[model samples]
Target chain A: MPDLNQAGLTITPGTWLYRLPWIGLGIGLAGMAGSAVLAQGHLQEFLHAWLVAFLFFLSIALGGLFFVLVLFATKAGWGVSIRRLAENAMATLPIFALLFLPIAWGAGQLFSWWEGPGEDALLALKEPYLNAGFFLARAAAYFIVWSAIALWFASRSARQDDSGQHSITRRLQAASGPCLILYAFTVTFASIDWIMALDPHWYSTMFGVYFFSGCLVGIFAFLVLVMGILQEAGYVGQVIHKGHYHNLGMLLYAFMVFWAYIAFSQYFLIWYANIPEETIWYLHRMHGTWSNLSLILAVGHFGVPFFFLMSRVIKEKPRLLMAGAAWMLLMHLADIYWLVMPNVYAHGPHFGILDVAALAAVGGVFMGAFGWALRRRALIPVKDPRLPESLQLDHA
Target chain B: MAFLSPQLPSTEEYGVLGEFDSPRSLYRACSQVRDAGYSRWDAHTPFPIHGLERAMGLRDSRLAWLVLALGLGGAASAMVLQWWISVHAYPLVISGKPFYSWQAFEPETFEIGILGGALGAVFGMMAFNKLPMWYHPLFASKRFQRVTDDGFFISIEAWDPKFDVEGCQKFLREIGATHVEVVLR
Candidate 1:
């Protein structure tokens, strides 16, 4: 049984975690100031780098949203203890609307279709949907929908901690299915608009699923790391055990394979068709050091982790599983970078200071929001009806 | 007797069987049995009880290793076959591409790997469990039929090194078995 007492549930004051929000916000401000100084002659580069950082963090949060929604939709009993952490991650979505300002402001430079489709015939044909007004409007719609769902579910779950109401669980479960549908459409178009539109003439129908798979990989990695960190900090006590970590590791492995499948499928179809428009995208990526990064993603992201996480013993070991998770999180960042950076550095891969600054900027703010959400409630949903079930979860 | 035929049962003592009213009692008894250093014993329940394997002191199965070996072997063989046929045997230039196009070979490789892993899992499990046996001495007991219904039972085969007909029966009873019986082979 779990230590259900208040001592294990809440963050103790003056711990590093209690001050995470302030520290994160401070780093975010400094990062933003550094980015401003770095952007003088390289506004286009800064914007592209910022977009990569934004999408990388945003995918993790979106993965968090999907995780929370699925848990409620299935009324999964074993995941209830960890659901609160995902809720905290999802609750950070509203801040991404603010983080999106750079991309929105630099629309003219980052996206080719932003400036009235210019003289390109194919782009002009896509102008109806790719026009600036509609694009911004769609981004707004996505944020509004995402923010609303994130806030509603997160706030209600937090409220359940106070009210101890089972009705809230029922209501969320009933609403989860529709919310997921909204999530699917919004996430799909959002990826198409932001990442795929970077190479406006090139498109793959599998692009959205590819992005979604990466999001799952990101969230599972993030959860494993966060769960490890929180436990090491003396919170959650014995509430979360090896069983939960094993499950998280399994998910991390499963989604890594899923991401590889979708990514390879997209490449396979384009390579097979041999159409110039479709193959051009792969041609650019396959030519330079970008190809090296692509190869690294295939091996690092899927091949190595495949064999590492296959054993039940490794998954049951927290430190080993966390190591795999951290490596996966890095690969996930590289994946987003691969998708966005090839357009900017057509010659090869470029690692620059602005890239790190942009990540620090966006990531610091994301952590700030996540930490703020974390500090606001119990680390786990203390009053959840299935909390006992999650606490008692053990693998046979 | 025919060569390699199934062994015939003898009219000698085969095992001692114990019946418990519930999973909890059976679980506790299993731990005692395990701690008492008795091997060649197994617990039976109508449905799976979590952690019972731990109580029975079972080690992890070796089936995963079998699946992994067969799966990799299958995929590698598939790739080699495709390369041989496309590059060496016929050398047909389909779609104007290279002779050894690994991209085209991937789908078949993956499918065959899954087939191999699946076959390994099924057959490996059967091999480990020793399935398709026509009969067991325990089946002669009328109460043992309840094993598929509401019964929780623990059976200690007479062949166990420490087994003694009267001693094992008393041990089961002391460990909370409601009913204990000795079965004939």
Candidate 2:
């Protein structure tokens, strides 16, 4: 029998975990800022765009943590070994909740739809969903829902180790259906608030799916990167079998396809309709400095990832698979940069120091918070009733 | 008289020469013997037998894993190559678009990943199964020639410790075998 009481996995901060990645951030920020300044474009707007990027990447870390909880709650056997690494990131939600204060502070500078001193015609028009008060309230509500679901499921699984009953598994499964639905709704509105509102006049019915696919892709990438770190350190020795890697690889493969589908659906839908409000969104992105960024995203996000992830062999190899996963994470960062930067840098695409520093600053803080959450308990839900099923999963 | 002394292994002692059988009963008997755990025997159908892998208790193929790895490698290579070309190498300013527009790269990235995965699967399947095996050892038997036509057969090799030329002939005859053949390797 597996041991009931076990110490959780520990990822000490010495792996550059605590120290802020200032070097990369500085370089990135400098590149972005220098480009904007030299071009004599809108400096203030460019910096604010970088700030939004920091928030966007933070969402990746937060969303990953949520995925970790969902897998645990469902006793999802396929992702067991990788689930712990995901949990490492999920534990950072409360930190992100606090970090969102900056967006609240710079409301007018970032979102043109937010209420300003004047009548704010656009803000008034979107009063139902785009107002500052409703925005922060929804933000809080999203956290509340996500945190409750994650905490309840995580605690139940951990408690099962001592209880050794099937109830914990049953309970989590019962909650997963509703939790998944809630996750979908919450993410949809969250995307609407964070990125979509950047261009309030523009709308796509498929925008939610576009954001969701990237989130899941980011989730897969983040999980792989974290697991790679753990494996490199020798944590999951035998429990993470070849079959498990094969499955994780396949899921990543599946998501690569999914992300592509949603992305295309959004583009195809908007382009096919060709309305002024919608067409102009593509117009800004497809011309001038933005056009090249759009094309790069086209090939980088879909073309390369789609083809490479399609193979079965690449998904199975740990080193090869992780390399792809890391590449995807970088792609996601670039993807968000493309989505966010065009708003600020009307002159061109900026890839400078502030963009880099802001991301590092947020990442360091989020990691610090996530580490604290992991320290509270064991990495895996030792008491989960489905633990055995996951421990020796047989496949055809 | 031979009962008192140990007998020698020979095709003549096995009784009659090999004979071909129709595919239906041959497959049925092969399956029954397989179910009985006769590891030394092999089925010889005119064409590839469907569900034979499972019937033989073969383990799942590693081909899927190979395909997955190849797909991942392809995606990685595509991204880096795209990045290198756009950012470091060529860095072309096409149509006023950024040299590193990720949106445009998605379709190509997808293609590369898929191509790698496909190549991996085909190659992996061949490598894992040790394919390109132009021949099987059983082809040496004269009776085995019918396996290419409208015939199905079973040959329990002489190497099996339980195989006895006389005893096996009697066993086959009692089991309603149309013809029992002793094959020379």
Candidate 3:
């Protein structure tokens, strides 16, 4: 058994993570500057790349928010030890408001509907909801709702570490149900505004769920990777055991399947209906080299990971599960790229240095904020009532 | 003539029965028995004790493999059946699409796969546990009846190579069994 003392639950001095915030910020600024320089001639490509990176990291943060809220709502105990990591991840939501500025600035170039739908009757009919002013307004509202809930839960949980109050947990539990309803609405609209709006003429009610499933897949993969890294650095100690990894792996596997289910559902309906307006969106993706990427997404995102993560032995072993997590993260990026990039490059897949640069810019700031949040508090919610249960978690 | 009836042990004794006072005692005794390399034995309790399977050194069941095999087989057969019907046997182009529209067949394929996996899990579990067992020699012991409520037991069958009635009963008693007896046919 691990020592459950305060010292064991904290980051030791001189650890590499202490430098993460500054280093991550440095890389972030450099990547942003690089993207700026590259955008001189290829402004459209830059915006599209930035949008992909933005959505990728944003999904992870949203996933963190969902995780914390669901844990509180369900009164889950097994996740108590890992809750703080998720808390720190969600606390980075406010920074995404800052990161979203570039997407906002380049919205005209990124979204074709930004300049008013011309000669397209369908887009004209959908004008009020798809207008630029309302889009920005809605974006601001989403940021406000997400940031408020994220900060409230994160701050309360952090405060509970000092006060060690059970009332705080009960209050959070009470608030989680309402917060989740708000989350579902905002997340659905936000996905519609940010991603599905890229092709204004075509729409799928399932798009929100599809994107939400990806968020879950992204966050679970991120959590697995973070847990593995923290354990490797000797930070979280032995409090997190094989059972926790197994559980995280199970969640990751579940959401990965969910993503496929939603993706396939969206496609199956569109394929069966065969309406011109609906099928046009898929036609762009199914043509030329994009088809290969689509096939790869179907197989890589679902098929390979399905069998790879099925075995209990794989999930229990840190290295194997971490490997699976890393691969899934890559596939998640591919999924977002598939969503946004197909709009920009209608002919085929074009992966460039801008994509990497944009990822670094958005991803670096995300990591920097996450590190800052991590260092500010206990790595685990030390005073949570359920910590003991979480620490003693074992699967039969 | 006797093939249709439940078979009774031809020998006078069935095996040794040890009554543990609680699940804790049974768990520890199970570990000892497992360490001592007894193969044909099982523990009975009114409710599950967590990690008791680990204490008894039980390996994971092979049911998952069965489920996967049957699930894939079901999906494959469903797809093949659709292909044969649409592309070869009838070749009716129903929605202005090609004769072989794999897209339309996927939902049924997925559902059938789940059905296969569900059936596999249920039947596989039963098969592994040797279910539909109407008779067990341990049921002959009056104390064993308490297994549905309060009793905890460790029964080692006589067919085990290491079983010696007296030695087994002494071992059980040493391991904190409240009562040890030789169950009969």
Q: Which structure among the candidates has the greatest TM-score?
A: 1
Model 2: per-residue Cα lDDT over B26-117, one tens digit each: 54565565665656555667787655554555556777777778888898889888988998988888756677777567667879999999
**Where in model 1 is the C-alpha error above 4 Å?**
A1-3, B1-11
Estimate, for each residue in A1-396, the C-alpha lDDT of model 1 and write its tens digit.
Answer: 345778767877899898999989988998899999999999999999999999999999999999999999999999999999999999999999999999999989898778786789999899999999999999999999999999999999999989889999999999999999999999999999999999999999999999999999999999999999988898886789988998888999999999988988898888788999999998888877888998999999989999999998999988999999999999999999999988889988897999989999999999999999999899998889889999988886
Candidate 2 error regions (>4 Å):
A3-43, A46-52, A65-75, A116-124, A394-396, B1-185
Q: How many steric clashes between backbone atoms does each model show?
A: 0, 78, 0
lDDT of 2 at A114: 74
Candidate 3, clashing residue pairs?
Answer: none
TM-score of candidate 3 relative to the true fold: 0.96
lDDT scores for all predictions? 0.92, 0.66, 0.91
lDDT by residue (A109-147, candidate 3, tens digit) is 978888998988888898999989999999999999999
User: Over the stretch B1-185, how does candidate 1's per-residue lDDT look in tens digits?
Assistant: 24223243343788899999999999999999999999978899999999899888988989999999999999999999999999999999888889998988999999999999999999889777766566777889999999999999999987788989999999999999999999888
Q: For each candidate, report its DockQ versus the true two-chain complex.
A: 0.71, 0.06, 0.71
Candidate numbers, best TM-score first, in rank order: 1, 3, 2
For model 2 chain A, the run of ten residues with the poorest summed lDDT = A16-25
- Native-to-model Cα distance after best TM-score fit, residue A236 in candidate 2, in Å: 1.3
Question: Model 2 - which docking category?
Answer: incorrect
Question: Per-candidate TM vs. native?
Answer: 0.97, 0.66, 0.96
